[model samples]
Target: MVQLGSRAGAPGRHVVLCAEQISKSFAGVRALHNVDFDLRHGEVHALMGENGAGKSTLMKILAGVHTSYDGSIQVEGQAASFSGVRDAEEAGIAIIHQELNLVPELSVAANIFLGREPLIGGVLIDRRSMIRAAERLLARLGVTIPPETRISGLRVGEQQLVEIAKALSLNARILIMDEPTSALSSSECDTLFKIVRQLASEGVAIIYTSHRIEEVLELADRVTVLRDGRRVVTAPIGELSRGAIISAMVGREITANESGKTAQDGAVVLSVRNLTLDTLGPHGWRRTLHGVSFELRRGEILGIGGLLGSGRTEILESIFGVSRGWRDGNIAIDGAPVDINSPADAYRLGVALVSEDRKERGLHLGASICDNVALPSIGVLSRFGLRSFASERALAADMVKRLSVRCSGIGQDVAALSGGNQQKVVIGKWLGTEPRILLLDEPTRGIDIGAKQEIYRLIFDLAAQGLGIIVVTSEMPELLLLSDRILVMCEGRQTGILARENATQEQVMRLAAPGMAAWSQVSAS
Candidate 1:
């Protein structure tokens, strides 16, 4: 490995990358404006801002993903202008995007060495050499994933690790990590932090971007915050507190832990009895969920907490009738048993699911905001057998206003909106259906602090309106904040349910830990 000159503990390291007067716009809208940034060798510089605050835009410009941006970049004190990602790579820059970019049909080794595979005799591909290299990289990261394993076979967190390994394979001097641990477990995050520190010690410059405040406080040497497409502040991590960082990012003090109105003891609205699900994996049928039971009451938020693959999302999928598996469960709405064999049935019964992956499952990116919001209510908005454009527009306009979606107009494409706005569109889409029961899976996954506050407020307002909500989140704080009653899951089973008064982080983790036998005692008590 090339040593650029280490300064692991020193904050005055030499600059490895710098950007001046960086500005980018999409169509006629300004996404970034005169943002200046610089990174030092062997330093983790965190770039923070709410969604659409131009962090992603600036990173794209640096990584050569957005070539039309107006900026001057310098590498090693030399003027650098990249026309494409290839140019950035040649300049020893690599970016691990927030979204995974891999071929699901390909093996891990193939993905790692994609577009630059080793060859024999200048013609034939050297598969054996590639697999060996991939194995070494995975081992270096302290993971045991086989090089020959297909990407589709791995979980989301494992896929993120592969992205990291792929970036490391480039031998880049500068690395940009965008929300790298959003899908990782706590143990996996610790491993990643170790690797990051080791790389920094070896003189690699890293620019980290995340909405996670604690991770930034722990990992970054210095932090820069942006807002409304402009640079707000840049300061050393030691000089910043959590409140300071959030204030700089959002331009306001946010009480993230402020308790909302307590849920009323309303009547039971939905109940599940001994729910079980069997999914068809590559190795045939595997039981994904077992004996999961819960009750959601009107004006209550029921939060599900668990590790990745611990059946948190599966529970929501099964309830929304979108699980790609055979499910055996008894579901009752208002004390009457109901059969939900498909999403249509669930919809007809006033059940709406805001999926975890908003880009893929929730919204149609290419469609207009009006189109996406009016999708679910199309049938109801139509006139007899004819489509009612006027009514659709009216419904879309109403939802956009109600959700406070920031957009030019309803005619704008959903893809052009920010991450936060896109999520609002997803929720608005479901709300148009006027569902009594709402299921939200990672509703604020990639969103920033300001948007999170908005969504939290929305949830509280919905519950106050007597909407029964079931939320599945990996964030412990979010789980504790939103739920009136928390259901902790481990593997496929229900561990225990803690009422809001008793739901501490320790108690939730104790129940969420796999192979723990304390559930019986907790349930009995």
Candidate 2:
């Protein structure tokens, strides 16, 4: 049994909210058991757990999304029962979900004040007042997005900031943020941390949930870890180490191991020379990639590392024939030049891409696991121009078993699974195509530590089987861990490539930094 730490060093702050004996179930599945949690005024309490460990369920209950849960909630020493989100808002509570909940077609100001808009004469909406209020909230967060800009026009990090601004607009006493920084850059994360500190200082109690342990350690005053739907431990941040937190979250020690056999001398599988892509943005055709060149050897992992909008993802998109831009490059697969104009052409040439945004671009959320996994192989599985259910089921079952996807069999809807499992389903769908080269973009984003380790092992295993892989990731540790060689990018240009043994975080960052003349010369393997 792990000894829990006492909440010390803070004496005057009283409990602002509490949940006693909270338990929830969904479709005969026990999502959470009897769990006790509380938040103090001016505290950043972090909730940590693996995927499907009941963290989201608990947060939803507190946010009034799930009103059927068995629990007793107290707000400032008064028993409170919230029937809906409006009731929770009336109680001065607001929650930002892990998934962005804003409408894409709506403007930034419209999304910020979605349901509750300012009215002129208590009848018509005052667009000017709403925009002004939205601007103030964005200004408080140090964001400069225009109030009238459509949500679809913003990047993922910007969208996340908009979500934060939306939560702040409620002026709630209690705020819950679920995986808020999953899509943010380092600088964006720093800005968010400053805002979180400021909010806590203003006596706003916050319940923060994230899979990033370092962020939790830096920002959280106390941590409550849940495992298998039960509270594992609640301890002050000062009393716990990284190892302790991992152990509490996964019930074991996590060991770091090499991904797979280092195959530096292997045969070249794919080669790109002077790759350039130009996309038609709001400002007309803009160059996104310029003179990017690299070679991927069979059984080697090449990592693309850069800051946001640095053309890291664009490289993968171009190679996989999915870039919505004009491409100018020399691509050779197995020493033969090839032209890939569409995803089908890329697939025919033994190439597969797992997109960064799995929910939006990778998987069909409304479909079942079998349907999603079998989608990429429908042509192969069809007989006499008709779909074969037996073949699809067999393929789905095999992939599910190989990937260790936890679900109610392959018939379960993809939306019902946890983040880690949904990612597996996406990978499985691409693997069903039997591609020789795999391109992964931010594959472990929003997933827990345990799931990330599993993905790392899988990537290594695939590489060991002589499959070439190109991975684009924002995580420094993941880039260092999985890449045999790291390709650093800056402003759509290739900075340099560092060998695995020689690549350090500092070296990668130096090359990744824009306008760094010292390492501007690109190096190829």
* Overall lDDT per candidate, in order of appearance: 0.89, 0.90
Q: Write the per-residue lDDT of candidate 1 for residues 123-205, one digit (tens) a residue.
A: 99899999999999998887888899899987777899999999999999999999998877666777788888888988889
True lDDT of residue 258, candidate 2: 67
- In angstroms, give how far residue 90 of model 2 lies from its true place: 1.9
Each candidate's number of clashing pairs is 0, 0
Task: Provide TM-scores for the models.
Answer: 0.94, 0.94
Q: Tell me the TM-score of model 1.
A: 0.94
RMSD of each: 2.8, 3.8
Angstrom error of the Cα, residue 274, model 2: value is: 2.2
**Per-residue lDDT over 1-525 for candidate 2, one digit per residue giving the tens place of the 0 to 100 score:** 112222343324899999999999998989999999999988889999999899999999999999998879999999989899999999999999989898999999999999899999999999999999999999887778899999997777789899999999999999999999998866678778888887887788999999999999988989999999999999889989999999999999999866675677889999999999999865579999988989999999999998878888899989988888789989999999999889999999999999888998999999999999999999999999999999999999999999999998999999998899999999999999999999999999999999999899889989988899999988888999999999998889988998888889998888888775245566644
Best-performing candidate as measured by lDDT: 2
